[model samples]
Target: MALQEYTEFITELFESGKTHSEIATELQRIGAQSCSLMTVRRFCSDHNLQRRNFVSDESLGCEVLSAINQTGPSYGRKFMTGYLSTLGIRAGEGRVGRILREVHQPYNILRRQGARNLNPIPYHAEYMGHKLHMDQNEKLGMFGVTHVLAVDGFSSKIVANVTMPVKNNLVIYNEVYRAAVASNGMWDQIRVDHGREFFLSLYVQEKLSQHRFNTNRLPYKQTTSSKNLRVERIWPEVNTRVNYPLKRALVDLVDTDSLDMQDNNTKYCVFNLTCQVSQIGLERAVQSWNAHRIPGRGIPNTLAAGGCPQRISMELLPSAAEAARMYEDELGASLSWASAFGTDPFSSEEDRQQAEQVFLQEYPDITVLFDRAVNNDLSLFQDALLCLINATNRFA
Candidate 1:
C-alpha cells in the first residue's frame, strides 16, 4: 500500500471539507489497504493541507467579536465556542479566549446561584432518572406567559420545559409531566417547590404507576429555590435565551399595535401567531441548551448521551397503543387527520397549500383547536398531533 497512490483521493476528500479522521474512516469503509487516522493526519500536516484559509489574527478576532455581539457577552466560554463552531469557526476554548482577550471582549461574570448562602445544601443524583427538579419561572409573565421546567439533578440537562399561558395543575400534568415522562421516562422521584400547580396533581403519580414505578414527589416551600439548584440554574439560561427576546418582541408588537385586539387585556396573548412564534423560540432555546457542551463537566457534554435527561429513557416510555389511548382519553376524541404544519412534509408552496387544505378538510376540529391555540387557551399542538397519528394507525 503506497501512500502516493491515495494522495489524490485524500486531497480530494480534504478539499471537499472532510476532516482527517473523517477521511481515514471513509478510506477504511472503502477498503483502503493502508488508510489510518495517523497516516491521514501526518499526510495533511506534511502537505500543509488545512480546513480553511489562514485568516489573519485580526480577522479572526473580528469574527469572535461579531459572534459575541450577536450572542451577547452573557454566554460563557463553552457556549461561545459551540456558537462559533456553528458559524464554521473551528477553534478550541484556548484560541477563542485569546481572540476575546485580543479584541478586549469583556466576559460576563454570572453570579453563582445560592452564592449568598453560607452553607449550601449538597445535592446529588446517581443516574438520569434518579431525581427531577421541577420549577416554574413567572418572570415571563410580563410577556403574558410562564415557563414550567424540569431539570435532571445529575447532568443538569433539562428534562422537559414548556411555556404556558397559566401555570395550572392540569396544564402541568398534561404538558410538563407528560412531556418529561414520555421523553425521559419516569423518575424514581421528583422534587418541586410547594406550588399548588405541581402539588395538587395525583395524575402524574397514577401515570407513573402504570409503568411499574411508584413516582414520589417531594414538595418544599418558597425557601427551597436555593436547595433546588438543579432547575433553578436552568432559569438563568431560559431568561436570557427565551424570556428576554420574547419580552422585547412583545413590547415591540404592542407599540406597533400588532397584537390581536381581543388579546390586549390578557396578561399574555394566546393568539395563534403569538403562540406559534413563542413556541418556536422556546423550543429552539431548549434544544440549544440541551445540545450545549458544559466545559470541564464530568458527565458527557451533549444532552444526547444517556446521562442527560433530554435523552429519553425508552424503557419507561409508553407503548404506541397506550400513548394513543392516553391521547384519546385526554382529548376526548379520536384524531382523524394528519397535520403537517410542524413536520414540513411538503417541499413546494403549492404542495404545502394542498396538504394544509386536505388536513383542514379532514380535521375540521383543528380549526377549533387552532383557534384555541391562538385566541384562547394554548395547547401543546405537536404532542396532540402525534398522538392523533398514533391513534389513527392503531385503528387502521
Candidate 2:
C-alpha cells in the first residue's frame, strides 16, 4: 500500500467532497495501510488538490493590493516581501509569493538578459573620503555643455557636479575638482579615466604630498565602467532627469528662434541661457539624488549610518586662500580665478594704504634696483647675479 499508488484515487475522493479524515479512514478499511488525516491533508496540499482558502481579513489585504498598484508590475515577490515587512506585516516571502501568484501580477521586472560572471572583488570603500570616483559625460555636448561629476565610493553621495562649455583640464580643475574638494574636503584617492582632462594626476599628488598624505591616482584606461560603478551609475539619472529636459527645451528654442538664433551675439546669449538652465537642473538632480534612498541600504546618503561624505570629511576642508592658490596652480590664470583673485583683497582704503606702506617699508630698496635695471646698470653685479639676489634678500 504505497502512498504514490493512492495519489490519484485519494485526489478524486477528496474532490468528491470527502474530508481528509474520511478519505484516510476509507483507505485504511481497504487495508491500504493506516494513512493519518494529517498525512492525507499534507498530500492534498502539496499536490494542489486541496482548495486554498483566501484570507478573510481585508485590512492588510487592501494595503498589499494598493502597494502592488503603486509599485507597478515591475516589482517582484522579493521586493513586495521587504515592502510588506516595512508596512508592519509579518508575512514571509513564501506567503507573499503565493499572494502575488494568486493576484496574477505579471513579473515585468526589467533586467538585463544573459548570465554574468560573479565578481568576488568589492569596488566600494569602507569609509567615507577613503576613495572618490571622477567621470565626465559628453552626451549634452551638442548644446555646447559637458557635465563632470565626482561621487564618494562609500556613501554614493555626489560630492561635486558641474556643467562646462568644454571638457578641458582647466575647466575640470576649476569647475569640478575644486568645487567638490571645497565642499566635501580632500579624498585619499581619486579614481578616474585615463582621459587628458584628468591628466593633472601628478599635480594632485604634489598637493596632497605637502600635507604628508600620499594621494593615490587610480586612472583606468580601456577598463569597463563597472570599475567606477559609484560614479558611473549617476550618469543615467542625470541624463534622464536633467539632460533630457534640457535637450527638449533647446530643440524647442531652436524651432521657435525666439531670441534671434541666427545672429552670433544672439546665439551666444541663448546658449548662455540654456547653459544656465542646464546648470540649475543639474544642481537640483544632485540634491534629489543625495536625498533619495539607496536600494537595500534603506537610507539616503545624507542620513546614512556611516555619515555623509561631507561630514566624515570635515577635516579636509581648505581655507579660501589655500583653495585659491590650488586653483591658480592647477588651472593657471583662468577668467574665473583671475576675477576672484585679481580683485582687491583689502576691504577698505585704510587697509590698502596700510598694506602699501608696509610693503614700501620692507622693500624700499626694490625701487633702487628697479631704477638701476631701467638704467641698464650691468656693472653692479660684475662677479655674479648672486650678489644682487643677496641684496634683494637682505633689503633695508
- Cα lDDT of all candidates, in order? 0.56, 0.55
Question: Please, what is the TM-score per model?
Answer: 0.53, 0.45
True lDDT of residue 109, candidate 2? 24
What does candidate 2's lDDT look like per residue over 247-286, in tens digits?
A: 6555554566543334443333333334554675566457
Score candidate 1 by lDDT: 0.56
Tell me which residue pairs clash in candidate 2: none
RMSD of 1: 13.5
lDDT of 1 by residue, 228-318 (tens): 7778877776666445654554555457664432432222222223344455545645654664576445422254255423334555445
Question: How many clashing residue pairs are found in candidate 2?
Answer: 0
Which parts of model 1 are misplaced by more than 4 Å? 1-70, 84-90, 100-120, 199-202, 210-223, 245-281, 299-304, 307-396
TM-score of 2: 0.45
RMSD, every candidate, angstroms:
13.5, 22.9
